[model samples]
Target: MKMCRTAAIAAICMCGSVFAQEQDRKFEVYGFADLNITKYWMEDNAAFRGLRYDDKLRVDLSHVNTYFDFRPNGNTRAMVELSFQGDPVANRSTAGTTVYTVSQGGAVNTVIGTLPLPAAGETKVSETQGTTLEGNSKIRALEGIVYDWGSFSIERAWMEVQFNDKANLLAGKFITPAGVWNVDHGSPVILTVKQPFQTGLVSIFPKSQIGIMERGRGYIGDVDLDYSAYLSTGRIHNTDETRNSLLIETPKDLAVGGNLSVNFPVASGLKIGASGFSGMQKQEYRQRIVKVDITKPATDAANEAAGLVATGKLDPTGIASYIQTKVGEYVATQALNPDNHSYDDVMKAQARENVFGVDAVLDVKKFSLQTEFNQQRIKNQLKNDSLTKTTGFYGLASYKIPMGENARLTPYVMYERVMQEGADNNAGTFMSGSNTGTPGSVLEGFQTYVGGVNLRLFTNFIIKAEYSYADVLTQGIYKDHETVFDAGALNIQFSMAF
Candidate 1:
């Protein structure tokens, strides 16, 4: 009986120890979702003829995110975020053929005829007994559905280790520490339905990076200072090149970036910050080259040589020599055309990019103000090296009016401007174009005005409505002409956080 009682007490103690360990480990699951209905329109200008969006009303499941945060011990924490996005559209590529008329000196090569080079890189050379060559051409076509479907992606997955009050180590894929808007980018958290020009439109800094970061905070009298420094894989350009080809490549070098900010705890809140990023972007354009068999064409040419010999125009012994010469010339021509070979890197361009941003925010009583400015410069390292520059700025202000104990109404207004040199500016449109002329030599500008109101019905739910107007102008030579584009949109969104 004493042994049984001791065993029961021992089991109870073990249970208590397990419960205490469980209490020490902390886990949290939280996320936010938002849906938007938008009405959009644009003037029928020739310059904006090929714009992606049309004048119509649309409903979109804009953002859905789920986050997991776990802390197994006092010094370590892990976080993961999953984002649901619109689905990709189905697309099909149609085969095409391009015919080339080869002419050595001033006369066309009648023996080769017109060579039909298909998009797949397969070519056929047919010889005809004619003085003139016929040309045939077919354009490549791509067709896809108009609407996007639903998809899932991982937004952030990272682990953080706390060394002390003044230092912490973070590793994995994390959001880049840049401006205020990018850090608090959730729909439920941001004040406006649309993000600022710099943060969302012409992102001066990359959205995320994979690497390690060291961040900490310190106090100096009444002032507080926080800073972050990181080394990451940097930004990638021409990402679609790999998707279109069979070859895969990753960035060969690392990028370094950092940010610093100062905050004052007076009134509601006040903060000022600056950020910078520098990296080298490498791109290689490649295309697939299908090998073609020249045996049939060479045989036909040799047969023609035999017919000439039968007509007393050549000797039978020269037939072998004729075939060999023809085959050699065909091989030489294929060598000159890189497309005739398989897996060729057609062109390579390398550029170094530097970006800088400054931001400030102030809150006093029910009134708040926020503003930011960002600039990015790209320098081409190849021949005809030139520099291209892009700049963006925005100012926002809002005022809150109390509605009830757990509800409030906030109205806000914003003005933004973005400019690019030596390129066509497509800010806020989610499209980018190559720079032309001398870098930083052409002038392009975009301006936007926005007004909105937010109704916080509950602590974790909000309704927002906004109207925005945009004007764009380009003063550079585009096929030898100037261009302008203007548009407007009305958006209503429902956002919730849990």
Candidate 2:
């Protein structure tokens, strides 16, 4: 860890010196990075075997971002952001009593002991190092780095031609201009945690999409209003790759789209804002052979009450006939088992699809609401299988109390529900590590509820703690099947912005 920090510091100093020398005489350079220290815990006694804290007290330094803007003269400028980042780190338990500190190249402390595991009855985990309970204080997970950090490059490249404060036009690749949290870069002002769930669903957002847009702002009488209209190139995560090319062949591809936003004061301290985007998106995937395995209960009571057989959804006779245990390529002993299981060499069925969606946000003082609803248009011409066209939305509310002068307090709550579509074989559980595509046996849509409190000292340094609960029930095509995988996450973070 010490060596890691030392090398990182040296590299930053070198980069800063070089950049300072290269800055455009009329250009400005600046950006921000989020550095987080968190403890993640999850418990699924049946599936996990026992309670555990994946990466207890771990430190994660997010990707560092630096943006440069060339102001040729007055109201016009070209801007781009270069970024460098490292994966996250977490605590590991060892077979010793003094194992309660987050492992760092630094000294051990009390607040962190083997990355805070779910306190007694908790059942959820956000991020952690996958490790056994055998106990070693050294850090074990380095996956985040292998995948998250690398050579720095222009992550956001765009040019803006502004006519004035009230109007402008922007073109090139850029971040999404919708949702307060969407424009955030590791800052607390945009959220309550290190990341937002919507980011993983970029399948739903047009952020970083290449495009050109027009904007304008002004006041209607005593009220202020802002708006924009844009057109963009198709969303492209598959750029320069075999997977991308394969997607061009799939139905979930984003061929093109248009986006727009409008914000205005509602009344007094309240405000109403709405923004929406629509586009053609499709995903590319490799077609794979699906092996079927259906386990049926001898008694109808178990099948009836178990919630697997929804009304008119499950064909008991057909389901019974299809109950042959055929393992997938990824399901074999060598592939899924840690031991010498030979099932690892099988070929797993791989397929892809494309979809499109629209989303918007509205805020008024202590209450802020955001919603996203999109569907994957079925294109059976490409393949044959049932995929539920999914849709959902989320809302959040927060209140800040200004206590006289120095003390500030805030309380927040948020809720999200993803509706199941008859086509979604996986139900509502968007979580991937587990497979849910097979008929009659699949996980479905996810519903999450979050609430927390925060206190700020001096307004610059903040201590925020939050508790979140998620209930995953009624999954797969119309939420037919059911199980209980309820869990909770508690996180406290310190942040500063300038």
Candidate 3:
């Protein structure tokens, strides 16, 4: 027993020595954040646009890096970062759900607070149900930290093992490196409000599934190549639930997908690259209601009346050939259930075809030509709806005109077309609410032609001005619309590494 106690004391001494040694290590820090305020003149009832949409301002107050990046001996080091932001503005609409003329008209869902929808657009829809998670229309503060071990996966829980040259295992809630937008770090001044077509909107990562990603730099003979294979359980966040997009977000929901890219160095000062992704993404959604005029066929209306009489008025049970059972009555009675309100009581299967994206950049002297394109096949289980196989694409070309020594001016033109969903259903509005039937105030798909010029002075301050015109896509009578909006800004940033 005496010998055992002595050994235990020795072990404790070793632990104390190790702790003392760790106290000798050191850490490094860097990164910056700023604040920006903006005011826009958007059309009244115009489909709502956001920071990355038309012209919006972005702000950042705090972002720092603190990590013990220097190792004592081994080729190993540890690093961590805590990012922060103190700016937030809601992009929600004034129109949610409204009880239109409740003097005993059509079926009444419930009597909650009423919000008036626009007269020109479809009636407002209510956000009845869906998954719930803390979200940010604009980043407030990022309390997340990043850790790196042995330099495997540079970020997140994924690791870049040394066994393979250009292979990595990516997991955790990490951002997808899909486009040129600087989402790895969020700053509109650095990242264009209108990201390239290949990259998704500001809030969306191309693919941020909580799964594994195997990516690395490799080669196809002398051509030289880089590829990534990813499998994840995730879905794109449904920002506008009232829209006709296929939404199936739920817990236990998984999305498995992958992306591949190949880069070819044609010659000195000349290189080209391409990449794509495919996967199964599903989201379970609640009911989406817009103020839709139900012009039932004479026979259909007669059948509804008969069912109403048979089932009693309080629970009028009607059945259309397409809409089976008494769905309206069932939901009207149970729409507010904590866990029971949904288009389908059970989790429905909705899938979005992995997007096929490609971009090309040509290097010429100090200037470059960059063009990006993407095609999304929004696959839905239920067909015959006009919203099948919708697509969107944008193409822009700019020339960096060098002026004198410390300044450059870039003037560019772009053409973008976003196909509207449910095209056949006139007055078919994309509601932002669930089952409330109110149209979301924002519309994205339109033939928006943009022309802009950006001027940079002393490589620090940049001023970008753009003018856009569009024909809003909707059943509304407004057409051939034209509006002009622009922005001018000044910035200062500096970063040093040790």
* Model 3 collision count: 34
- C-alpha TM-score for every candidate: 0.71, 0.57, 0.53
- Tell me the RMSD of model 1 versus the true structure: 12.0
Predicted candidate 2 versus true structure: per-residue lDDT over 1-498, tens digit per residue:
979965865554344422455545566655555565655444543211122224356565655666676789777779888766554212222222112222344333232222223234322121122122123122121111112223455567888888986889888877755544555555545556533455434234544567777777777676666666666644444321122322333334333433344444452243344445544333332222222222455566665554435573555333322221112112232222334222111112222334444454555565555555544432222234444344556666677777656667778777776644544332122333212233432345567788877666654456677777656554444333232345566767665432
TM-score of 2: 0.57
Per-residue accuracy of model 1 over 236-348 as CA lDDT, tens digit each? 32134322221224453567888899999878999999999977655554543433332322354555644425444443334333433433355446634665545555334
lDDT by residue (313-336, candidate 3, tens digit) is 322223221121222332344434
Best by lDDT: 1
Where does the lowest 10-residue lDDT sum fall in candidate 2? 139-148
Q: Select the stronger candidate by lDDT from 1 and 2.
A: 1
Poorest stretch of ten by lDDT in candidate 1? 136-145
Q: What residue runs in model 3 are displaced by over 4 Å at the alpha carbon?
A: 1-29, 32-39, 49-159, 162-164, 182-193, 196-207, 220-222, 236-253, 267-274, 279-349, 382-387, 401-409, 421-444, 451-471, 474-477, 480-498
Error of 1 at 240 (Å): 3.5
Q: Which candidate, 1 or 3, would have the higher lDDT against the true structure?
A: 1
- Candidate 2: residue 334 lDDT (0-100): 23
Query: Candidates ranked by TM-score, best first?
Result: 1, 2, 3
Q: Clash pairs of candidate 1? A: 87-149, 87-150
